[model samples]
Structure formats: C-alpha cells, structure tokens
Target chain A: MTIGLNAFLIIAGLLFAIGMLGVTLRRNTLVMFMSLEMMLTAVNLALVAFSRYNGTMDGNLFVFFIITVAAAEVAVGLAIIVALFKRRQSVMVEHLNVLSR
Target chain B: MADLLFYLFAGITLISALVMVLMPNAVNGAMCMIVSFLGTAALFVLLEAYFLAILQVLVYAGAVMVLFLFIIMLLDVGEDSPAVKPAKLSIFAALTGFVILSGLVISLFTDPASLPATPAFEVAENPTGLSANNGIPFTTSAKSFGYSLFTKYMLPFQMTGFLLLAAMVGVIVVSKRITETEPEAETTD
Candidate 1:
C-alpha cells in the first residue's frame, strides 16, 4: 500500500514531539540545539508532505526558506554556545544561569 | 512495498531520535542525530522530493552533524553524569511529553473524518497528488523551486540572504576576542 497523507503527518508530529522532549529533558546545550534542529526537520517533513498532497509548490518553496533560516540560526546559535562554554567552562544549562542571578 | 519503505524510514527516524535524546554521551547523541537526519532524507526521497532529499543529506547529515561533532570534540565534552535517579523536573518533563504524544496520536486515530483526505489526494493514486496548480504545473524539482523562488519569492530570497549575512556577522562578533576595555567583553577568547 502507498503511504497516505495522514501517515506522513503522524510521523511529523511524532518527530516534533520527540524533539520537544529532548529540548525539555536534555541539559546539554549542544544536544538541546540538536533537538531544535530535529524539530525544524520535522516541520520540513510536514511541509513537504502537505506540498505533495495539496498539489502546490508553496509548501516545498517554504521548506527551502525554512532550511535557509535554520542554517543561519544553527551557525549563530552554535557560535554563541561555544563562546558561552569557553567563558564558563561548562555546557550544562543549569550551570549557565548568570542572568537569573 | 512503498508502505514498507515508509515504515522502515519512519522507524529509523523515530528510533534514532529517541536514542539521541536518551543517550547520556554527547558524542553518541550527535551520531544518533546524524542517523535520524539521514532517515529523514530517506523519507524525503520516498515523498519524491529528490532535491530536498539531496539537500537534507548534504546540509543536515553532512555539514550540520560535522559541525556538531567538531564542537563536541573541540570542547572535549564528556559523558553526562550517570542519571541513576532522575530529578523530579525530568520526570515532569517526560510526563508532559508523553501526554502531548498520546494526545496527538489519539486525535489522529479518532478524528480521521475531520482530517479527511482532500480532493487533490483522491485524484491520483501516485501519492504526489500532482494536480495542476492555478495555470501552473506543480513539481518538486529543484528547477521549479528556483523558478518560484526567483519569481514569486524573490523579495524573501533577498531577505534571507540579508538574514544570513547578519547571522554571520553576529557569530563572528560574538565569538571574537574583545579588548578588556569593553565591559561587555567578559571572556578572553
């Protein structure tokens, strides 16, 4: 049997939820950032699925933009994370609470 | 056959994602993320978005994972402390995630009617549902994407370029070694 739209959506939702779980439960900034990227890929999957099922190019096109934005975000975010780690000597989220103080 | 491939890729994606989240070692987690991303790229191929699949492999699996691994290795990241007894907050977070996942799955199964397949989906057995757009044929080829981006989305394209430039400058500035004269420059690196 061919895959259906619903199946694709469910997979997307599952990935998104897993990413969310990682974001909440994981304490490492690097892993947390990776989780964020997972969520973006999940969104990309959903968009491509919708684009395929709806017979339109909008979703696919938007996926490109999303990818572009995600790339920029990852670069900047990683740079900041590295700098933070260099300054603090730790990548644990709880240990980097200077602003909360 | 196609459904089997979908399930296989989906299984790979989901399992690797779970492992990435649950694994205590940062390096292992990053490796799992690579597998998950590759699985996603496979799914993209299944969906016939060949160009997107190629980009997914190149960007996510190749560049991004390499960058993550580089940072992890450069920092000499060690395994997370053993979590023999997880903290209370972690339990709550897991509960929240479970509730969300169950809610989504339940709604998906129970409300298929409200989420009924659209007419476009019904018009073709090919799953791509390649219906004619408003006077424009639709395809997922890289060329078609370029056409739309340059035509309908040109402004946004330029905007994304600017955004990338800003992010690049911001990263360089944030990571640069600053003089001790500036109070904001707290780190020597």
Candidate 2:
C-alpha cells in the first residue's frame, strides 16, 4: 500500500501508543525520559502530517515552538535528574520519594 | 520512491522504538530513542514539512536527545539496577493503550476530508543559517503568522519564554550544589 497521509497518521498514532506504554510500564527514570521524548516525536509527526494534509504552514510553525520547548525541557530535566542522582546514587522512580533533598 | 522511503524509515522507527523499550541499559535505550527520532524526522521530510523536518533534526534529535544521552551517561545508570515491570499494572495499561490506539485508527479512517485545499508553501533554505527567516518573510500567510505571534498569541509565547528562563535558573541552582559538595575537587586548589 502507498504511504499516504493516512498511513503517516496511523504510524504516528502507533508511535504515540508505544510511547505511552513505555511511560507507563518502565520504571527507570532515564527510560522514562526517553519515552517522553518518544511522545514528543509522535506529536511532532502528527503536526507535520496535518501540516502536509491541510497544506498550511500553521502546523509547521507550531512544530517550531514545540521544538524550542522540547529542547528547554530536556536541558532542565537532565539537570534535575543529575541532581537527584547525586543525592540518591540511583535513578529508580520508587527510590526518589524524598522531595526535601 | 516516497512509499519506499516511508516504509524504510517506518520500519527503522518501529524497530528502534522496540529496542528503546526492551534494552537493558538505560543509556542504550536512550540511544535507540535517538535513532527513532531521526527516522521520524526523515518521515517528516517525506510528508513535505521541510521546515519542521529540519527543526526536528536540529532541535529534538540534535539537542534534546543529546541532552538525554548526556544525563544518562552522567548518572551512569546501568544493568545492576534492572528495571522491573509490575505485572498486574502493565497488563491493564497495555490493554488500555491498545484499545485507545484501535479507536484512533478507526476514527481516522472514518473521518471525512474537510481539510482546506490551500497550496503548501515552499520552505526557504538557508543552509548557512546566517539570516533570520522570520524578519524577512513577507508572504501573506507569513505576515499573518507574525501578526498572530505578536498579537493574538503574544501572551502564550511570552509565557513559554518566561518558563524557559525559570527552567534555566532552576538548572543553574541545582548544578551549583553539586559543585559545592565536592570538597576534594575544591581542595585541588
């Protein structure tokens, strides 16, 4: 079958579902981060597909801002992960309940 | 040709996505995720969103994924800490996700094509990356976008910028504590 816009949309949805599963199933904080990125990628794919289908630049422009915010999120998220690791010497979600540190 | 590229990249994307989830090492999983992101970017190009495709490569794959990799390596999380899946919870979650995805696909196939028939704009190429495409853009749609960004959407844009600044401050504060705690490294003076 030809990979039309519909195909792309389906693939994006599948990716989003897989990402959601990863986020819910996995416990490692780092893997969770990767799953979050996967979610973002799925959204990006959806945006670009809609942009192409509608033949409008609006979705593409929105993707630009999403990219900006995603970058900032990663930088700050990594910093926090590093900080948390320094304190606990572990990156498991279950072991990170102490908010004070 | 397009279908070939799509299938190729889609296969790469799905496989890497599986690797991302199934990998034992967190660092390796993150790397697999990076590959998936690149495949997604290539798919974006095939979809004709050239600008979004470039931004995907530049920002998400290049910056965000790299940051993830850096943090993963920095923390050095490994095989010793095997990630456990809670069996009962995962089965429920997986079933829910599968049902949702099925619904989405069904709805998508049934959805009517009411999408507007506007001509796709040719994305300007600035390989040198020397100039701001924003300031020079004078197309009617480009002008409308600029107006919306500065007028209707101005508040949201400013809020996002402020949030980024706050995140930057937060990162700095957190990293500084790490530097101060290392007394032996401090004693190297």
Candidate 3:
C-alpha cells in the first residue's frame, strides 16, 4: 500500500508542467505570480520526497530556505504589481511595456 | 492506506491547481490556490516533513494567500475586461511544454531503479542518540532540524534573513508614491 518515490516524482513533474502552462498562457499578473508559486511548491514536494527516501535532512533544510525566500518574494512581487497597476490601471501582462519605449 | 492517501492528496493538488489557472475570476483563482496549497501541505505530511507541512499551511495558505486576496480586492480587478485572445505564440508555448513534459516522463519511468537509495544510518552511531529511544536513526525531528540549521547551515540561514530584509526595503522603495509636483528626474537629466 506504500507509494514509492517514483510516484511522487511523477506527480511533481506533472505539477511543474501545469505551473509552466499557467505561466505561459495566463495574461493576468497575479495569476502568473500564483503559477510561479505553484512551480516552487512542486519543487519543494520533490525535494521532500527525495529527502524522505534518502533518509537525510538536507533536502528538508533546502525546502525551509525556499519557503522563507518565497515569502519575501511574494511581499515584494505584490508591491511591484500594485505599483504597476497604479501607473497603468491594469494588471494585464500585455499592458506592461514600461521599458519598451 | 498510505498509497490511497497519496493519490487523494495528489489528485486534490493537481485539480485545484488546474482550477486556479482555468478560472477567469482572480478571486476564485486565489481560493483555488489556497486549496492547492493545503493539498501540498498534506503531501508534505505524508513525506514525514511535519515542520514543513505546518509551515506550508501557515506561510503559504494562511499568510501569502491572504496577501494575494487582499490585493485582488484592493485593486478591485473586476470582470470588466474580456478574455484575452490567444496569440500564435501560445500554441508554440503549449507545444514546448508538452515536449518537455513527455521527456521528463520518459526518463523517469524508463529506469525506476536508477533512483538514489535512501541513505542508511546506524542507530548506535547517531550523534544525538535521540533516535535511540525510537530505534529509528536519522529521522528528521525538529530537534535535529534545529541542530543542523544552527551548526551546518548557519551561514545560509543568516543570508536568508538578509534577503528578507532587502526584499522589505525593495518593496517599500518600489511602492512609494511620486508626487505630481515633483520634477521628472529622468527627463531633467
């Protein structure tokens, strides 16, 4: 009844692919950001699975650092998004051409 | 039982994630993201990462998601805009993604036994002797986690604190308002 490591890895891969799809297809900045977070979560899952099967704590430690960095990233990324919305009055990625001129 | 739970959690995780992406309403998407995060936390628990499971719920589902919802409401991103037209590039992107996914599936399933074996540690040689009581050495208990964090990984831990501080400062700088009366600094130069 035990799930093997391969199953977890495969699930992680699928999740990562889904996240990549969201990033590529979505136009909204917030949704794109959420997709990026999804990708990170997938990576964390893979690391934990490896850690468990390897009987080590290194992967777990790496996951802890990733979670910390992701929190900071969310704070700053949301702030940037808010600023962009104020300037352009839209959160659509298509509208973001500030550097193009 | 564990296999069943794994499948359940995995199903929840993937479904919610798909919903998050497919839902047009940003609010609904955020809610789905929360559910996905919860499913991920459940998977973490099954992996024996207890601390991370709690942190995932608290940090991702509890805090980060609330932040996203707050912004979604504050901006008032109503359903005013129509769905974006799919450009030609979207097809290319989808094709590329599919190719990558297929490659990963092939390699992973091709040689299942090539996966690294879980490192085995002798119970008698455990440094802290904490596992001696349970007869399971190398278990990543919170105590051992703390031990490794403070001793072996202290530098990276400190660096993460610095990174957070820098992010906080950057956020403040980026979000600060520029008054209309102020001269256009870039143009003036």
Candidate 4:
C-alpha cells in the first residue's frame, strides 16, 4: 500500500474544507484566525507533496517564504485582535458592527 | 509501508484538523491545530524531503504553534458553547467538500504528467533532489539542500531574512502604544 500523491491531496482537501467551515461559521475572531492558519497549513502540505512528486526544490522554497509570511500574518493579526478587543470587551465578529455603521 | 504511514498520518491529521475546526473553545482548537501541524510534518518526512520535514517541525510545530498557544493562554477566554449549524447548512457544506474531493481524485488519476515514484537509478543519483542538476556534488546527503539555499537561492534567502526583520518591526509597532493620550473613561457609550 504505497502512499500516493492523490491520497495526500485528498487529506489536504478535507483539511481545507474544515478550515473554510470554521471561517464561515465561526463568529469569534480568534477562532477565525486559527481557521485561516489551518488553510495555510493545508496549502503547505500540498506544496511539499508537489515538490516531492516533481523532484524539484522550487515548491519547497516557496513553502519557506510562505512560512515567513504566515508568521508575519499571525503576529499582525493577533495585534489587531488585541487592539479590537481593547476597544470592545468582546472579540465576536458580530459585535464589530461599529464598523458597519 | 508508504500506504500504511499515509493512512496513519492522514487519519491523525484529519481527526485533529476536525477537532481544531469544531472545538468551540479557541484554546482547545489551537491545541488540536498543533497536533495537526505535527502530523503534517510527519507526512513531509515520509515524502523523503528530509530538510523540509525538519524545518516544518522546527518552525511550525516548534516556534509558531507555541506562539499561538501563548496567545490563547494570555487571552483567558472561557469556553463558549458550540454554535449550532443548521442541518441544511451543514449538509450543504458536506456536499461542497465531497464535490471538491472527488474533483481532486479524478484529476489525480487522469493527469498524464505525473511522475512515477520509486525510480531506481534516477532516485539514487539525485537523492537530494536538486544539486545534481546544477553540477554540485550532493553525494546522497542532506547538505545538498543547504548548498542550494546558500548558493543558487541566496537572493531570496537574504530576502527572507529581511522579511523576518520587517515582521519583527511590524509586530512591535502594532502591539506598542503610539501615544500617551490622556486616559479616557472605559465606557460602553
């Protein structure tokens, strides 16, 4: 039962769906951020798998840059979360109606 | 061997990813995400890109996820009850997922350009997967990736250093106080 790239891709697809569900259904800002990270991780898995299958390091290099971006994304995102939570005692997206007005 | 490991890690990754998404408690969800991250790193190892596999473990599972956990702990939010998804809505999501998975599986089977795994001589000669093409003496070791990173890819490599530096500055600016404005009343008004 040798592992196939298809099999790994299927797993990644499922993870992406879960992440999408979390993003769409959850109202909590922190939870949404976690879901976004989930999607990014799934993408990284796909990239590495592609790199292996193609016998090239290009995808791997891109994944490295992506990791850098993800780290930066989370840091700034969390800072925004903290600032928003300070403005309003809640981190719920629904309560951010201040922006809608 | 590959099939078994694939299934095992796939199971762990999927299950933990599900927990990460469905757990109402953000802290619990983040922990589950860490489990999922580790499982992904294990999958990378099985793919035989040893350098990438190690970096995945060190950077993602080690540094980044720990920071996420730290934020969760600092936030100190109580567990909120799971938000109920409407039955019809959940079914719609399930259907969408099924469609996407089936599409990927079909494409995987039909694509003619896919490489055959377990190529004997080719695999042995280019064990590190990159250096041989560029006339570097890889000698079937992990250092090949390092050589490529420092040599052929040095520009982007240095750019990554700059990117990290900018990220550090951005984090500091975003988190720090901009001005000592007079203390305003904490009002819900």
Name the best candidate (by lDDT). 3
Q: lDDT order of candidates, best first?
A: 3, 1, 4, 2
Per-residue lDDT tens digits for candidate 2, residues B94-161, read 76876787587757654646333344444443222122433322122334455546754678789888
Tens digits of per-residue lDDT, candidate 2, A12-98, equal: 877887887787777788887778888888888888777666544556667767877877888887888888888888888778767
By TM-score rank, best first, the candidates go 1, 3, 4, 2
Q: Label model 1 with its docking quality class.
A: medium
Per-residue alpha-carbon lDDT of model 3 for B15-87, expressed as tens digits? 9998888788889999999999999999998887888999999999999999999998999884426766657
| Evaluation by TM-score, superior candidate among 1 and 3 | 1
User: How high is the TM-score of chain A in each model?
Assistant: 0.95, 0.90, 0.94, 0.94
Candidate achieving the largest TM-score = 1
- The segments of candidate 3 whose C-alpha lies over 4 angstroms from its true place after superposition are A98-101, B78-80, B110-137, B180-189
Q: lDDT tens string, model 4, B1-189?
A: 777888889899889988877787878887888889889888877766566677778887787777777776676653653463335776577567646765765576446465344331223444343454654332224666676678778999888889878878987887787666544554534
RMSD of each: 4.8, 6.5, 4.9, 5.5
| Span of 10 residues, lowest total lDDT, candidate 4 chain B | B118-127
Total colliding residue pairs, candidate 1: 0
- Model 4 residue B10 lDDT score: 83
State candidate 1's DockQ: 0.58
DockQ of 4: 0.42
Which scores higher on DockQ, 2 or 4? Answer: 2
lDDT of 1 by residue, A18-84 (tens): 8988888877888889999999999999998887777677787788888889888988988998898
Q: Tell me the TM-score for chain B of model 1.
A: 0.81
Of 3 and 4, the candidate ranking higher by DockQ: 3
Could you tell me every candidate's TM-score relative to the true structure?
A: 0.88, 0.76, 0.86, 0.80
